[model samples]
Target: MTSLNLLLWIVLGIALQVGLFLGISFWQHWQSYSRLRQGLPEAAEALPAVDVPQKEAAGWSGFRRLKVARRVVEDSSGHICSFYLEAEDRQPLPSFKPGQFLTFRFDAPKADGSGSEQITRCYSLSDAPTPEHYRISIKRVPPAPGGIHPPGRSSNFFHDHIEVGTTLQVRAPSGHFYLEPGSSPIVLIAGGIGITPMLSMLNWCQAHQPGREVWFYYGVRNSRETAFAAHLGAIAAAHPNVHLRLCFSDPLAEDQAGKDFHHHGRVDVNLFRIELPLKPFHYYICGPTPMMETLVTALEDWGVPDSHIHFEAFGPASIKRRNAGAAIAGDAVAAPAGDITVTFAKSGKAAQWSPQSGSLLEFAESQGIAIDSGCRAGGCGTCQTTIRSGEVSYLQSPDCDPEPGSCLMCVCTPRTAVTLEA
Candidate 1:
């Protein structure tokens, strides 16, 4: 055949193949649709729309808040707010080993039909376990993209409108920042609102056993923004073993009453190395991103071993731990890699999940399941559930696991088809 005829035949052959594929696909789709229409009865009862009502979070309580009715403006710093909340669950609040944080739920405005509920965030519980309440000092973050705030939410709302008697839904406390109880001669480094968790350790020390030599290096903008100053000062005065050092990035008027409370500039590696006691001690450090980076690097440069250093990032561990490895949560369970279904036993609801969803906790929350949780970072173990039938890829060890049979659904992304008893 001529070249033109061969080209024509080839073109026709390609067209025919494409037409055959399209016809088969269309027929298959029509058959499937017909079967679905016949097998599924006409919508006799419409599905009840998910009703996620808008909720208002009340002020904090438990060891979280002191008995005194102190409003946000009541404290000397004006940044500190104290208030009470009616117990919601009546289940005794979970105890912590000082240095853990409480995750609180806050609803945000969403234009989509999702009813404006947003992610839950955790803040360090600043009070001792005994006070029977959780206390957290928030610095009021601005709206940042890809963070808890797409617009004003959580901390911003807490600072702006949260008032006394406004009950907040709090998760159980969890953290790794607690003192080992004579872990080493203690050295705490804090910047800005980072003082909350460290303060918990300090408070516990003051009441329980007062002899451990403790030193605090707190950095803040100025005296006006410093929180828990008087109370911390009292703890320092009452316990001679406790030494407090304050640094101010911006110190107002020299030789004044408040001037004594301030340090000239930022708290750098030089200052920390010089001010800290000569003896090696357990170091608990927290603060802004830059401060953490600088201090942690400084500690390493000063020959501090990883075993001796402990720190809590201000918010999520995402920012705080840059090179930290993923925390695994469960023992090895053999299962095929595939889609898994999560059944909320209480609500009679189930949601299919994949690794991309991050954790069962996130999936359930997205599905509007009210699983109590704190420190979604896997430290607190509040959003834990039993492995009913299938298995999960728990990123954290089972020992620190919340419940023995259960897994912390936060860091646990499914590696196989799994069903959790929610």
Candidate 2:
């Protein structure tokens, strides 16, 4: 093989692969159109779309010891991995809403190496519910570019230490961001690690609501960063009603235009506008704060109603609704002229709070008071603290259902002079 011949062979191989992919895509699309022209089979009863109530999450209640039965690498970039967990006791598992998350309690080692600190974290279930196992996909949050901040502790532990047979304490799956049980059309938008829950929803739709139309848009940097590439493509090809678009913001040289990804830019409403025919679509979006805020705002600007615009935001939400119903649901905090006092009863600490000061947790941290917290977005109840008195208002709507007598310190601010059993 001469140098020129070798180059020709490589080019020919790539061309063949691209041709095969395009052929498959076109065939699947034709099959879908044929099915539509013929008409789909009637759907069965609709499942409930409501969020899982706390008490109803699992009749067993509390955390259960589950062991990792399998671990699979999801992406070529070595960033995303999935773990399949089975109850150690071999008992039956509770069913969850398609987009719910499972909470994990970790005894992470302290920085001083003196002892372990109890840390809580939440990861969304990444597959449809099964009788034997539950799966979760997680991406390792790499260290900051300049090392300004340390890498995520829980994610690192899962990647480095956790393996098949590792036992873990996991809570029942729960979250407000889930696919409602309905036959209506829906739009699923996911970015980076945010694709975890969307996977669950997509899988469930395929398994149960096979006739329903689903527009799934997943955004990644490139092919290497993409998870379940062939799997998603296969799903889309299998179901004509399920439309999948892989959007790569920065595609690699090896990535082909039609096979590797469908779009060259980020996943936004513009793509939706360009691709989808005008119709009412309930949106479920999950991604980074900037992407979430920008996409949600754009959708709203496009006349999508607040109720139709459902998004999953972990950590304190940075997005705010432009609609008049923007205020988070809760009793009005009676803050007298932006003047409020919050006291940590356990620590005998009191501090003044203002909108400029931030959330109760942040305000407390600034005042040198420490509170145990996880997810910081109110998805995990680690920051739930007993409110001895006074009212608190959530700066953003929480995905976790609020407690009757407590507040998630990470998301809420004191409305008046409040004391908490932190």
Candidate 3:
């Protein structure tokens, strides 16, 4: 054969091979596209429709009027009551993130026939998210030892009067401190009634992320004050990934170490330092002011990243420290340059504001002005009051947003000459 003819034959053979390869590749690509297109309908159906109106949806955009579905007296060492609430229309409930709270509005009748008084209180959801109902566990708070203030009006009202068939007006679930479960290890710390939110997180983890490692450290006065002992015990027994540590500051004689309580002291960061791995982990804390203050400061001193530490203060949002020099998270206030006057229009009282007074609520109390408050940390809107004249700033942004013209006195400081209708 001639040299040119041989070269032409080799080039033709190469072209044919290339064409075969391209055809095979195109066939495989087309097969994949066909399979994906076939499954598109199922995938689209599984996703929630965004354009559909949510009128029949379980969650509400604003305050919803719900009826008390049931009231169960949970067996506890303290006077804790659980109320199961369902939508008055018997609609499905919206799912909430674990550790969120529901704000309630109550119009309790006054004794002196001076008309009804409006009170707002917030309670953490005590159970996992369900489509049927929401549960809240409330502890009856008695008067302080000094008898300076009255007993918890909202809690006492729930325990005394709220029953099945009663209607309650509640806002949607909202809060900043919540669990975002992942493969990362988590440590949950609770004190007293703070266990309500933690229980929600624990139950969610058990149901959704059973393999995730969870360390729950709960602290209480003693067995007599501990709530959900049997429920916690049962959970610990069933889940191997969960490590339950019960810390009783003062255990009774009948309380055993292995069975009744896991530790006999307070649940502090020091206890966590010894028990948990010194690695990147999320730490969620909720409890009394002192406990939260101690744990947050200790964790910061121990070099834990601030983003990793999440906490919520239980009552009045003020975390008091034994040593005044120590700083507490979510309580840092910017001191004003000079003395500012705060006037309570309804009470007809005025006071010189000082940063040392802590919060506007504290200053009002010092001036002998009666102002209602709950969960002083700004998570609850109980301390919300109308800011009629002046601007105020929050030490930390509130988890539950207040009304447009109002501010949370518990965490707010006056920015100018302020006038409030409280």
Candidate 4:
């Protein structure tokens, strides 16, 4: 029991303790590495490759011609149809963010045996993104009650003429309205055919972020008019985090509450206020003009920040503010002083532009000058025309930026006496 013996014993004990600690750390590291190795295959299969380049080129380039793969009747009444389109060359298509749209150009045959005229339209992508194909659901828009004007040229053409194997030219998917996958609770509000994009967002969230909470509120006229009922029901049943609410403004006698629809009457802020928590939630809405305007105003009044509320109006950009008159029409620019002359170079038609005409496209149409136009809110770029001379101004910045020296006639007005190659 001398000092040297004591020192030797202490050194031996310290070495043993260090060895034990290192052994435990090595075992823990081995366990984590083993678990990660086991999960590697599944993770690789679930997510896209990070190191390899994207199969389909990166960034939006231009239109790609695609062929119609198939068509499916989504509703019992045959009013709504879903078109599945695939790349004509059978190559992988570029991926898109959920809630984007596909712009299509159609050479619709004239009723007479004269010839075909070019028509353009934009439809929201209805399904989640996949490399193989894209899907768009379109509602057939019949002519007005009196049959005065012709039926919706593009929609009816798609419903009646387009078939499987038909080749169609479609621009790559593009849109400002898209879902940003995040931890924020999502509230999707859709009306009638506007549910297409919502369906895309819903399916994407369910597949990619299954744990995210989602609440979907959809409105239609009646049970018979309800499109994708079965599909929506299946989604709600599968995803426990999703809350589905359907409102029928005019439910038929057979339409039963809690079975066919969750509520009766049009969807308004009152329903949302009652059902949804007042906490921060990202709201994405798309619908008819009136419904979009009403909900946007109501949500703002409910103390929701402008940044949290996102919306897209289908067809023309005609959402007027609730109770607000000419001063604050959605996407409407004020008329410039003096009469601006708009000369169509191709048609050789000159018209004095008025504020009532709304847009240059509208002015040309009123003059009986045929100009192919689509998504008149300026998202599609279908009505982009060369401005030969003079200036034009936009009511609001277009979602799709036009090429230099050209203007989207659908949302622009003559800033001065303008000559356009239309």
What residue runs in model 1 are displaced by over 4 Å at the alpha carbon? 1-77, 83-94, 106-115, 143-151, 254-259, 316-422
Clash number for model 4?
Answer: 0
Candidate 4 — worst ten consecutive residues by lDDT sum?
39-48
lDDT values of the candidates?
Answer: 0.62, 0.81, 0.79, 0.81
Please report how far candidate 1 places residue 200 from its true position, in Å.
Answer: 0.6
In the order shown, what is each candidate's alpha-carbon RMSD? 26.1, 12.9, 12.7, 12.2
- Residues 30-134 of candidate 1: C-alpha lDDT, one tens digit per residue: 764554333332232132222111121232333242221234442345555544332444434445677766666656555345677654666776776653455
Residue-wise C-alpha lDDT for candidate 2, range 1-422, written one tens digit per residue: 89999999999999999999999999867765554333332233253343322344553457878999999999998888899999898777788888889999978886557988898999999998787899998889877999888888888889988989999998778777788645657899999989988988888887777777889999989999999888898999998988999999999999998988999999987888789854446789988888998998998787666767788875566677786354344443333457688889999988878888878888889988888889998888888889999988876666666679898888888877999997
Q: Which residue pairs show collisions in model 3?
A: 316-376, 317-376, 317-377
- Kindly list the per-residue Cα lDDT of model 3 for residues 158-236, writing each as its tens digit: 9999999999989888887678534456789999999999999888777767766789999998888888888888998
Model 3 residue runs over 4 Å out of place are 1-58, 109-116, 145-149, 319-333, 343-350, 365-375, 380-390, 403-406, 419-422
Stretches of candidate 2 off by over 4 Å are 1-57, 324-337, 401-403
Clashing pairs in 2: none
lDDT of 4 by residue, 293-401 (tens): 7888897776565566778877676554333332232444545867899999999889899788788998999999977777888888888899999989876557678
Model 3 Cα RMSD, Å? 12.7
Looking at model 3, residue 289 earns an lDDT score of 78
